[model samples]
Target: MDCLTSKVQISQFLDNELPQELLQPLFYHLGECEECRNFFVRTKVVHEGAKNVEYAAVPKELDEKFAVLEMGEKNVSLMNRKFTISVPTAIYSIGAVIVMVLFIYVSGTIQEKQIAEQYRQTMNLTMPFSEISYDRN
Candidate 1:
């Protein structure tokens, strides 16, 4: 087995959770790989040390504050909520924005076409006849 797999198995072994089938392979790998063996030893030491350490109890004042916060959170009901948007309202809002954008775009396009036509008409009226060409080739 690889060192990575062996290290994970080592942790599982210390926790007494390694599968029976894997135990022999992990032991064999640990016996051969010095680096993984050292890692396993260090992890075992830390795990044992953690088990021996004592946990302190929470202070009464802090516990009381947390209890008050929990009560406050639980007291607020779903019906007491103020603001919410329905699906139809959101759909209508999106549709209105799309319509407005299309209106503006179409109006701008029509205005540009009208301006171009007017410019062509003005040029036809102002240019001399000699400059006009009637070639069809």
Candidate 2:
């Protein structure tokens, strides 16, 4: 119904991928909006131009280089290859390790606090103030 939604649907309409239920609403919006209409026209023109473009054949030298590279890749044995870590993988591994360490430290601190609280409570119960007295003669 809106211009933005209509513009997105325009591409789907051009590709014949828009559903039957959505077609009328998009058409209505396109009829009312000039900017969307221009967008639809431009996209249609580009799509038609791309469709009319002829495929260029690859050069013989480039094709030969690719073949050599493919052959070299196939000849390499898996056992002789060295393993490597990608940048993203290394970063993520370090991040996970840091998170795990922080979790352990925080949990340990909390457990220690709980134990100290329990010890204070037990000592208070065993030595209540009312049970102690001072004698003077």
Predicted model with the maximum lDDT: 1
TM-score of each: 0.43, 0.44
- The per-residue C-alpha lDDT of model 2 at residue 127 equals 54
State the C-alpha lDDT per candidate: 0.88, 0.87
| Candidate 1 wrongly placed segments (more than 4 Å) | 60-137
Clash-forming residue pairs, model 1? none
For candidate 2, lDDT tens digit of each residue in 1-137? 77878988998999999999998888788888999999999999999999999989989999988898778776775547888999999999999999999999999999987887687687875654456576986
Q: Which parts of model 2 are misplaced by more than 4 Å?
A: 62-137
lDDT of 1 by residue, 1-137 (tens): 99889988998999999999998888899899999999998999999999999989989989988897778766775447678899999999999999999999999999987887788688775654446688898
Cα lDDT of candidate 2 equals: 0.87
lDDT score of residue 78 within candidate 2: 57
| Alpha-carbon RMSD of each model | 21.4, 23.1
